[model samples]
Target chain A: MQDREKAFIRALVRSNATFGIGDDGVEISNFVVANDAFFEDVHFKRAWGSLESIVEKCFVVNLSDIYAMNAIPRFCLLMLTLPTDFKEVGKLAKIIGNCALKHKVKIIGGDTIAGDKLHFSLTFLGQRQKSRILTRQSIKKGDILGYMNPSSVLTHTKTQAFGKNTKILKTALRFHQHRKIQSNTRFAKPILYPKMLLELNSIARAGMDISDGIFMELPRLSHLNRLGFKVFKPKGDWLYAPEEYQMLYAIPKNKLKKMQNFAKKHRHSFVPFAKAVRGKYRESKKNWHT
Target chain B: MQDREKAFIRALVRSNATFGIGDDGVEISNFVVANDAFFEDVHFKRAWGSLESIVEKCFVVNLSDIYAMNAIPRFCLLMLTLPTDFKEVGKLAKIIGNCALKHKVKIIGGDTIAGDKLHFSLTFLGQRQKSRILTRQSIKKGDILGYMNPSSVLTHTKTQAFGKNTKILKTALRFHQHRKIQSNTRFAKPILYPKMLLELNSIARAGMDISDGIFMELPRLSHLNRLGFKVFKPKGDWLYAPEEYQMLYAIPKNKLKKMQNFAKKHRHSFVPFAKAVRGKYRESKKNWHT
Candidate 1:
C-alpha cells in the first residue's frame, strides 16, 4: 500500500471502525465478566512476536480479569480475528482449549473473524459470593495495598508502565524467549503465571487487575480509599515484562499476615506496594515517602 | 476485485463478519441484542450504501430489538466488511451515532474491514427491569399469536424472502411515519413491527415475535412443545418478506380466552395463527395441512 493508503488504514483503525458495540449498559450478575485482547499488526505485530506466545499471552491477559474480580471463571466467549495464514482452525482451537482447561476455565463460546491481524475478545461470566464481591468504589481509607505476581508482570494489554522500559506499546512480547511452534500445535505443559485464586477472600478491601501497569495501577487503587500510597520497594525482574496480571488488592492492615500466609499456601507471590493514606491524589504522589 | 477475492469476501461476510451472535454463544442475559437485514441494489443507490449502512442497519435492527426486549438500549458492537468505498470513518460514526442516540444508545465500541457488497452485523445491549423482560421461550403453546402492528409482518430474515420485496424496502428511503430528527440521521422507520410489552406476562401461550414466516416460526415453537398447529388463517402483509426478527409465542390451551382478553386490553393483534395438533413438523406445513 502507498502512503495515502496506509494512512487511510491507520485512520480507519484509530477512529473506531465501521462497527461499534455498546459498553457495559446491561444488568449483570454481581461478578459478571467480559474481556477483549488484540494480537499483532492490527493491534501489535508478529514481526515482533511469535503466535504461540501470542496465544498464551492472550490467555493470561484475559485471565487477569477473573483474578481482578476475585472470581473463578466458569465460561468464556471468544471473538477471534484470524489472519489469512492461519489455515488450521482446528489446531488453533486445541491450542486455546488446552491453555484454558489447565486454568480450570473453559472456552465454552467464542467467535472467529478473518482480518489482517489476529485480535480476540472474550465475554465470559463468573460468580463471586455476594458478600465477597470487589468493586473499584469499595476501597476505604487506611487500607493497605497488596501486589501479587510470581516474578515480572508482562501482558500484551494497553498498559503504561512497561512501554518506557521495552520501548513498545500495546504488547509484551519476550523476543528474548522466542521459539517456534511446529506445524502441529502441541505443548507439553500448561503456561502458568502467578496463580492467585483461592487466596483472596474477605481479605481484600478492593481490587483490580493491572492490565495498564503497576505504576498507573497503584495510584488507581490508592484513590479508592480517599488515600495515597508510598510504594516502598519495587522488586523482581521488573523490567522483564511477561503477562503479569497478578492481583492487586487493598487489604485492611489487620489482614496483612493472614493474606500473606494464604498466598504462601497457594505458592502465589504477595508484596506490599504502598499504604492507603488519606490525602489528595497529587499530595500523596509527591509525599509517597517510601 | 477478482473472482477469488469476491468469493472469499462473501464467505467471510456470512460466517465471520456477521456471525449470528446471540443464538450461537454462551448465553447470558443477552447484553448485546442483534438484528441483521439485507437489501439488494435497490436499498440504496449502488455506491451510496458504503460501510456506513452496514453499521447503521445493525443499529436499526437492534433498536427494534431493544424495543422488543422492553429495554433502553445503551451500546452496540458492529462488524462490517465492505467494497472499496468503505473508508469514511467519520461518516460511518456520524450515521451510527445519530440512529443510536435516537434510542439513547451510544457508539462506545466498534470494528470494521473490507468486502465485496455490504453486510451489517450489529450487537447491542441495554438495561430493563429483570422482572418485566420478554423472550419467545416464555410463550405457551395455546397462547394467542397477536400482530401488534396492523401495519406489516415480514417474518423472514432469509435473502430470498427479502429479495422479492424491493418495493417495501424502498419505503425506508421515503420519510417514515415515525418522528424525524435533525441529527444528520433522518428516519423513515422501517414500518416497525412492534410487540406489546404489556402482553408479555399475559395469558398468551408460548410466543415468539414473527421473524421467518409465521409458517416457519410457529412450527419451531411446536417442536418445542409436544403440540402441533392448525393455522386456519395467517395475518399481516403476507406478500412481504420477514423483516428481521418478529417472533411471538404459542398460547397455552387452558388460557386462550384470558390471553385474548389480555390482548384486547393492550390492543394486541392476537389472531389465532393455528390450533395445536399432535403431528409431525412436515404436517404443519401449510401445504400439508389436514
Candidate 2:
C-alpha cells in the first residue's frame, strides 16, 4: 500500500500541480484544498473513545493540514457512512456543529449514507496570502530544519494536570487511571494557531505537518528537495514515533535568531533539529552535544 | 440514517451558509465546493464491474454536482479507503488521472488509508461566473421546470449498441445480459456541458442534478421555494426511479424559447415536465396526453 501510495502521488505530479502529494494541501491560485479520512478500526476503535471525541478529532485532523500550509480554514464538507446500529445522528451533528463554531469554519455541504462500518471524511477549503504560502520543495542546502516537539505541546503529566483541573477533561480522566488513556483526549486534540504560522511565513522556506512521524516525513522533505538532512540529536524513540498535528519546517540559517524571537513572542517552542546538506538522504543516529 | 441525514443538514443550515443543504453545492465567494461518497457493496460490486469503471463513476458523480450549479469544475481531491485485499491502487490512479485530464480538472491533493471496505469520496472545487451561478432557493412562481430525462441520455437498446460498438463497453457487456446491467455504465457517466448551462444561466432561476428520483427531489424544490409543482406527465417508472446523472432545472416562462434553442444548439434534450404554482407540494399521479 505504501509503494502504491507513492506511485499514485508520482502520477499526479505530472499534472503540473502546485503542491506534491506529501504536502499538507495543494494550492490553487489563492485557495488551498485538502481532505483526510478516518476509518473505524484504522484510525479509532469505538471502545477506545466516545463518539464526541472521535468526531472532534476528525475535524482537528483535517484542520492540521490546512494550518500546515499557513492557511486559514474557512469551510468544510463532511461525508459520513454509518452502520445500521448507530443511532446518535443528532448528537453527531451537534458535536460537529460545535467544532465548526469553535474554529469559525462553516459546514457548507456533504453526503451521508449507510454502510458496514463508520467512516468520516472531511474536505477543508482554505486561503493563504500568495507570498505566505509554504511548500516542501523550496528547501535549499545550508537551511536549518526545525520541528514542533510533541513533548513541548503537552506532556503526560501536563495532560493529567489539565484533566484534573478543567471540567471538560475531568470527564475524560474518569475513563482510566493509566497516563496513556488519561491523555488520549489531549492527544486527539490539535493545537492550531494560524497567526503564529503567518508570523514565521516570511522566514520559513518550507514546512509540512508531521502526521506520519518525524523519520517518515524527513525523508519526504529530503527527497523532494534532493538534499540530505543532518539531525543534531536523534537517539530517542520520540524521533521515530508517529505524532499527529506537529509541524516540521525549514528556515534559513541567517534567520535563526529572528525565528527564535518570534517563537518566544508567541510563546511557542520551536526546536531546531537538523540542517540541509549536499549529500544522499541520511539521518544521524547519535546525539549531538550542542 | 435518512432522519439523521436530515438532522445533520438542518444543523448546518443555522450557520447561514450561501446555499441550502439540498442544493448540489455551496457557493463560497465565486467558487462552489461539493462532495459525494460511493461505497463498495452498497454502490458497486467488485465482481460486477471493472476498477476503471468504478473510478470513472466516482469522478462523474462529483462532476454532476458542479455542473448542476452551472459551474465549471476546476479541481478535485480524492479520499480513498481500501480493504486489505484491494490491489488495484496504481490502476485506480491512472483511471482517475485520465478522467481529470478529459474534464480539464486538476487532481490536487488527497488522503488514502486502509479500512474494512472500499470507499471512494471525491471533493470538487468549481468556479461560476458572478452572473451565471444558479441555486434552488431562487425558484419563483410561474417558472417552467424542465428535466434531462433518463431516456434522453441513454436507453437500454442504445446502451447495448454502444456496448457492442465500443471496445471499452465490450468487457462490461459480458457481466450480465440484463438491460439494467448494460445501462449501468452509462448511468454512472455524467453529461456535463458548461456551454449549454452558460447560455441558460442568465435566465434559469433554480436547478439541481437528480441523484435521488424526480419524485423525491421535486418536493424539495417546492418546499424550499414555498410553492408547488404541477407535473403534466408523471406515470412512467423513470419519473420515480433514481437516476444518477440527470439534471432538473427551472427556467422563466418568458425565456422558454431561448432555452429550447440553446438546448438544440448544444444537442441536448430538455423536456418540460412541470410548472411552479402557489400551493403545497404535490405530484401528478396520471399520465398526460401530450
Q: Pick the DockQ winner.
A: 2
TM-score of each: 0.57, 0.85
lDDT tens digits by residue: candidate 2, A1-290: 25555666666566454234667688766767788888775665565566767777788778878877878888888888867788776667777777788887877777877776678888888877767777777898999988654343444344422212233233333443333233343455546657776777667898887665566677768878999988886545446544346667799999888888887677666778889998767543321100
Q: Write the per-residue lDDT of candidate 1 for residues B1-290, one digit (tens) a residue.
A: 12232233344333332222233222245453433323223133333334444445445555665555555566554444344654564555455555655556644433344444443444455555454554545443344454333322332222222222333444444543342212212221232333444345444433444443455555455655545666655443441334434435455666656655665564444555566666634323221100
What would the per-residue lDDT of candidate 1 be over residues A1-290, giving only the tens digit for each residue? 12232343344435443232221111144444544434343334454445555666666666656556556666555656555665645556556666566656655434444554455655545555455555554666677777664422332222223223223331223432243322111111112343445347457877766544456455445543466766566643332332245567778888989888887666545677667666644421111000
Q: In model 2, which regions exceed 4 Å deviation?
A: A11-20, A150-156, A159-180, A184-186, A282-290, B12-20, B150-180, B183-185, B188-190, B282-290
Worst 10 residues of 1 chain B by lDDT: B179-188
Whole-model lDDT, candidate 2? 0.68
User: Compared with the real two-chain complex, what DockQ does model 1 have?
Assistant: 0.10
Q: Which stretches in model 1 have alpha-carbon errors above 4 Å?
A: A1-29, A37-60, A78-119, A137-146, A151-195, A218-228, A234-242, A252-257, A275-290, B1-195, B209-243, B252-290
